[model samples]
Target chain A: MTASVTSLVNQPYKYGFVTDIESDTIPAGLSEDVIRLISAKKNEPDFMLEFRLKAYRQWLKMDEPTWAEVGYAKIDYQKIVYYSAPKQQKKLNSLDEVDPTLLETFEKLGIPLSEQKRLSNVAVDAIFDSVSVATTFREQLFEVGVIFCSISEAMREYPELIQKYLGSVVPVGDNFFAALNAAVFTDGSFVYIPKGVACPMELSTYFRINNGDSGQFERTLIVAEEGSSVSYLEGCTAPMFDTNQLHAAVVELVALDHADIKYSTVQNWYAGDANGKGGIYNFVTKRGLCQGVNSKISWTQVETGSAITWKYPSCVLVGDNSVGEFYSVALTNNMQQADTGTKMVHVGKNTRSTIISKGISAGKSENSYRGLVKIGPKADGARNYSQCDSMLIGDTAGANTFPYIQVQNNTARVEHEASTSKIGEDQLFFFRQRGISAEDAISMMISGFCKDVFSQLPMEFAVEADRLLALKLEGSVG
Target chain B: MISENSPIILSVNNLTANVNGTQILKGMNLEIKAGEIHAIMGPNGSGKSTFSKVLAGHPAYDVTGGEVQFLGQNLLELEPEDRARSGVFLAFQYPLEIPGVSNLDFLRVAYNSRQKHQGLEELDAFDFDELVQQKLDIVKMDAAFLNRSVNEGFSGGEKKRNEILQMALLEPKLGILDETDSGLDIDALKIVADGVNQLSNPDNATLMITHYQRLLNYVVPDYVHVMANGRIIRSGTKDLALELEARGYDWVLDEAAAGVA
Candidate 1:
């Protein structure tokens, strides 16, 4: 019985096929000239070039941080390709200008990019390798004073907005990965919701990594002006290879007075084979800033892939009466390692935040939740509530929790709760005695355990997240 | 209520079982006919609980040498779930609590599993809700329990009532109550016994394992058997229970030993 359960989760990776096409890939290495070449390739403005140079100089002096609980082989910075993009003839004016093969690739991944097959309510910005291929509903969104386009296009069209808010929330020398991403991030999504305008449709971005040895560094920035609101989501996937790939991306969000921003992510990158031979190393930095009074920002993520994951999506409350929330569900199986959670920092009076995290580990994997909740001295009556739960499938797996809380104000209130559970034989037997198959039993229990986090997702994506978790944990327990 | 020509619901022959390499059920033999209620009384460590577990095909118990026939079919060949769907239900003495799974959902799933096995149409959430509400009256359970996690934070009597509630929903052919009377107060015991008595009919059989004779006062049994050393040594009508309750099991054990000598 145990052997059969172990074999259940050993299913092969589905999105492991590479697309064959002509790609303009740079040589493997990183330096000041590489950053300059990348900036020149994108035709960036002088100020943007200066920003990249400053970040590159700072990155040269910083060392890779070893504070996370994940272990891996040393990453040789000089042996990675900093830039890779599909070769195009000229600048794209619309979706018709996209390559047919590239559109076919996205279609096979269940993300239709063409006008005839695109989703009705969602406007997607499809990013392939290191460039944005196409963005849907651009004309409709433009008519309402909403600017939704590739970051490169925004840098050219709305340069003032980019120059003002770029690197404001996360500066050039914030951390190792953020600095590296600031230096050479090729393309990502850029959204600007004008004052008092609730964007007409849902905005999304789909990222696909195709090159074998090239690193993927994308940047996304969403700014909701006063009395405006926007909900955005992102998805990621990569092909399988013998050697591990590096993915270091940065996402920053800013919400002004009476504004709201909700950001969600469904990351399904290719985890290595059963022997842990090949996969992606995902290290990302994402943060949100409630910059004006009564602003709100919420982060929800469902992470199920990557051989080693190190990420912490955080929120900084800088305005009185602002609110921040983080809801996440992370699953790891078959020798995978993850150290992921959230951080909530209260700097304004009467600020509020909530964090709920669920981690599941199976097959000899190691999963950890490391979170922090800090309250400033002047923030009177600030409140925070955090709960972290971990579930183990087999006896060989490991689960850990490290929660750090710091409160300086005398009136601040902070509460933390955590628990660990395993899928024991008795639970399965009880279900079996009730005529339920083991497969159905395990899936039902898992879906129940993740109910709280799934409820925070958007309507359509909530169903997808539930199904994805069930598929990932099939036959993984007795 | 038993007729001489009635069908046999279960027949166990020379049943020998072991748990973790230690033999528990040694050469146990028994036969239960339709419409019959049989009670087995035994001292501790006499393999009473192991008998119910073995019949339910628990993974912990290994049937070394045994032949179990249910409705003239080889019962040992089926899996635990198949045994359940084919009309064998064991109400656990200590029901396991499953967190986050509501009682209504669990009952509906189990009912649908049996329905699917019998080649019948399964009930959706709306219809299953109506059906389960009617079944709740048998055990006198409140409607609020339908939304709570299955047996999680439930009182001891509430858990036992839930077991009987499942038995009502599944409607099995042979019902085995494994010391269901251990942790119930007198009021709860009467309610549970009334539930068992109401579920009894001309087509189903009941096997109750207990340590006290108080349960028999509510749901009277036709026969009472005393089990010792992993096997039944003496059997008689309901009068045997009255005698055993008056004078403990030592006299019976001595008589069985003298007969063996």
Candidate 2:
């Protein structure tokens, strides 16, 4: 079993093929001038440039956080290109106007960018390297008053909405990674569901980083207004590189009175080789604010890649009788390390939150779930329930759970449960005795272990996540 | 009921095995023909369970020196899953609890594996549901058990019954019940015994590794063997079980020791 798991963990990254296209890349470095250059290249307004400048100044003073349970060498910011975009002849007016090589790259990544070839119900905003390549279903979304486009495009077209809500949920200098992302972020999806309007279709964004030396810093903002609801999906992948790439993304979400926002992510960045030579350093900050009475926000994520992952998608329940939920499945294999969970803060009366996290570690990997649940003094009758489960495939892998709960109100209730289990020989033997192969048995067990979290994902995303897990853990057992 | 020309289903000779460097099966020998029900009764640590596991090709047990044949194929050379696909089933004494994997899906996978092995048409989900529902009747299990995770929260008797349900689904040529009667109540034992009896036929065989003679009253074995120190010390008809029950295994051990001396 160990041999098979070793072999499986050594499986090459499937999405590691780099697209050979002419790119307009800035020199590798971080300075005030670099930030200004990025903003100027985007033709941004003065306010946007000021936002980047302030964030860049704040980032320079903040120190890199080492509290996460992941180990990696210090990253040299001076060696990473902050901006890299594919060279294009002109601004795309239609899918045909887009570079065919770029479109083919998306096709190879299993994301059909063309309208006729795309999934009908899903509106996709494809972001490659440092720019939004194409966005489908714009007309349909516009008719419903649902503004879904790239953040860079939103800055130029809907600056009022961007200015009002941008950094409102996650302000500049919120954290080290968020600060850096705010300064250098080139493009990400922007979603706005109008008041009393429930979006008719699921909105999705696919992010890809093709340049090896460039860092991807995309900022996503989603807002669901009063009595409105929307479900947004995000997916990411990066090419394999011998040098670790930096990805510091920031996502903010806001839900108003009686509104609901469900954000799901399927991140499949290229993890380093078996020996941990190179991979993506994914440090992300995501937060949602339940801003009005009876509002709700939920975050569901399936993280299966990245050499080092440090993320916690959190929710702040500030509205009366609001609700927050976080469901996540983080799998680490072959020298990968992940420290991920969620935080729920209850500041309103009768607010409630639920957290379910499943972590699977195989092939000398380390996985940890770190979560916090805090109930404020005014959060009377607040409630929280959390369950963190970990599964280790081999003897050398590791799993840890650190759950912090604080309740300042006497009427608040908090409950947490944690369990650690190993995929022992007995379990595999039982499956084999029933004529099931070792790989199939392991996959079945893993799927079972993560079913609770997977159930919270969108239908198509759930299916895709399941297949990705199977592919990731292929031949992972004897 | 064995016919005159009954074919041999399983044959073991000098089956020596070990687990964690400790020799468990010194030189066990056993044989079973189609249409026969054989029971091996032994004391604890007598390697009765180890013998059954070795036959199923469990990875933990190292076959130091042995030869096993099942349906004219070299069983020892096959992987555990291949051994299972080749019509050999070992009903575990403690069935594993696989949380979140529906029993229905588990059964379908096992059933289809055997079907694919035998070159039979695999059943789809709809057809499999129909087929598994019919087989569930053999053990008198509730249909609700099919949707729950495989034995995740089942009672002792329910887990044993679920094992039988799996057996009924796979329809193996040689079924080895490893202490399946243990932890079962009188009623559960009767239900389980009845299920086994119903599944038994002229073209297949049953091998029951047990410690009690009480189970034999319901599913009568044609032959009973007394095992000690990893090898069968005496072989006889069903009366041997009653005698051993009345006189205890010490008598058989002393008699065998005296004979060997």
Candidate 3:
């Protein structure tokens, strides 16, 4: 229910145009029957099938996490459909050989799988609902000794790689969502850049939720060999629904000696209607690994959507001389609740990390920044600096910051700072006196609040993020 | 005809206001007319800024008593924005900064608010820019200043000059400059005073509130009033400013205390 441009305040659902899609969706329920059906339908190997069953058994024995700041009853696994796929799509030989309807669907989602300039060097894995749409550039990547394709395809073609790294960082029993994802992950990207060979262009995986009522469960894994570097971008969205949609995905990244990886996420899920109904629940587990000396990883995200968001893209520095950095801006409006941040664990000597999070809340929404930095006993010379700022626009909105630090090593240095302030009425009056309306003034004020993080985005994305924030935050203030 | 005895185009009778249950101004009253320049000099905590705050109808300040009649209408009844819309301007002592809101955008809103109040057609962005550029000349501010956030990161002098520029754009009937010259150097003081002088006309009145008489040497008030402890203790002509400057406020303090005795 997108509002007309003339009146941005009153419109309803953000991504409401349901595709005239025909999907093969199984009945709701998560049990041995559903797990076997998913594996049988995908024609998985014996070990893959066993992995799913083991994960399902582990999930049943585990209880739901009770520690998150979010408030919601335990989700009923019996009420969720584990798999759904585009009805007409079939396996194809080339990009052009893929279904035109499938390609058109992604194009409408603002993703281009075959753009001449960008597609030449990059690989594309388009996950439409619970199935991979068309993963192009895989043949070229394979020639260069790289592994780039859907996780399902990777499980079929390069099972050894998947067996080695899958569920290593976030195990099958890491958390409730992670366990569920491990049991029945429908589709996600799998990337492995070979030794000493940097991926020539950014590798991206686009996840589109087209089948209604079915929660999207995807799993992503990335590994970089020694002396190699790769930058990955993950983008996700969903069709609108009257009832809330659920998305619980798990992502893990592993880097070897002297390897580096930068993961950037631009999440634009449908944030439900302004009244806070029918948007997607974006819950994800993303983490990186520094397995060898001098490895580095950075996470940058601009979160502007989601009715309820619970995600923390984090990093674990297990290598000496490793580094991690996180920069994020989360905006919530009109019943949108976002409890997102990062966690950095320093287990190596001479490790450093920095986190800068900015949260803006408006229209009775709640935006919180929850982050942690823990240094281990041998993490001597470890350093961390975290600054979280919260800006509340209207009286009814809320903003909070919770930063947890555990420094066991006296040689480790850590610092955290937080401040919360409401947009002053005098500031609004001052702008109004100059000719800016209440809405435009609010936009200006928020832009200023987010300027620091906005400047950190890539050039094209920085401009896009700025304009998108302005559009989403329209009428965000009185 | 503009009444000379009614030298003030505006008059306030026993205005009282409070903020969050704490009274700041008690029965404040003053009068000003066209062609007259009045100086309202007062010691600290004497309801100087409170008078300006009340006139502008700051929501934080609640007027609990009396009334203010501006251009022959009840002023206290108007909202702060409406007060500004109806030719009443307050040059705040401490101008607030709104980061990321450009000076130009803020000025356009002020211009349109006044226009909309009178049911007049508002100007487009280009036309509004042209209108503001003309008034910026009165303050002698730089063209580049329009791109910066309102009062954000501006020097003390720039903030005051921006306030004066706003006054010129609104062209109010009764202008209240609250401690306008507090932080200005000699050169900045001359420039600010010169700007106020250029915008003054016989059809409008200016009430300058300050702690010192130094601003008078530039704008040259026709009448001066000494206020202390919430009331005006003495009134005199321009020479009174010089007398007060030579012999500080304690002389008026002795006379006021004796009168009370």
Q: How much TM-score does chain B earn in each model?
A: 0.98, 0.99, 0.94
TM-score of predicted structure 3: 0.77
Please give, for residues A237-318, the per-residue lDDT of candidate 3 as tens digits.
Answer: 7777767778999999998999999887778888877667678888888899888799998888889787888999898999
**Candidate 1 chain B: worst 10 consecutive residues by lDDT?**
B1-10
Better of 2 and 3 by DockQ: 2
Q: TM-scores of the models, in the given order?
A: 0.95, 0.94, 0.77
Candidates' chain A TM-scores: 0.98, 0.98, 0.93
Candidate 1 residues B149-237, lDDT tens each? 99989999999999999999999899999999999999999999999998999889999999989898988888899999888999888
Alpha-carbon local distance difference test for all models? 0.90, 0.92, 0.81
Q: How many angstroms is residue B127 displaced in model 1 relative to the true structure, after the best TM-score fit?
A: 2.7
Compute the lDDT of residue A171 as modeled in candidate 3.
86
Identify the runs in model 2 with alpha carbons over 4 angstroms from their true place: A5-10, A476-478, B124-127, B246-261
User: Candidate order by TM-score, highest to lowest?
Assistant: 1, 2, 3
For every candidate, C-alpha RMSD to the true structure in Å: 2.3, 2.4, 6.7
- Per residue, candidate 1 scores C-alpha lDDT tens digits across A1-478 of 3664576556667789999999999998988899999999998999999999999899999999898889899999889898999998777777977999999999998899998999999999999989999999999999998889999999988899999998998898899999999999999999999999999988999999999898899999999999999999999999999889999999999999989999999999988887787889999999999998999999999999999999999999999989999999999999899999998999999999999999989888899999999999988989999999998886778899989999999999999988776675667778888888777777877888889989988888999999888888774433
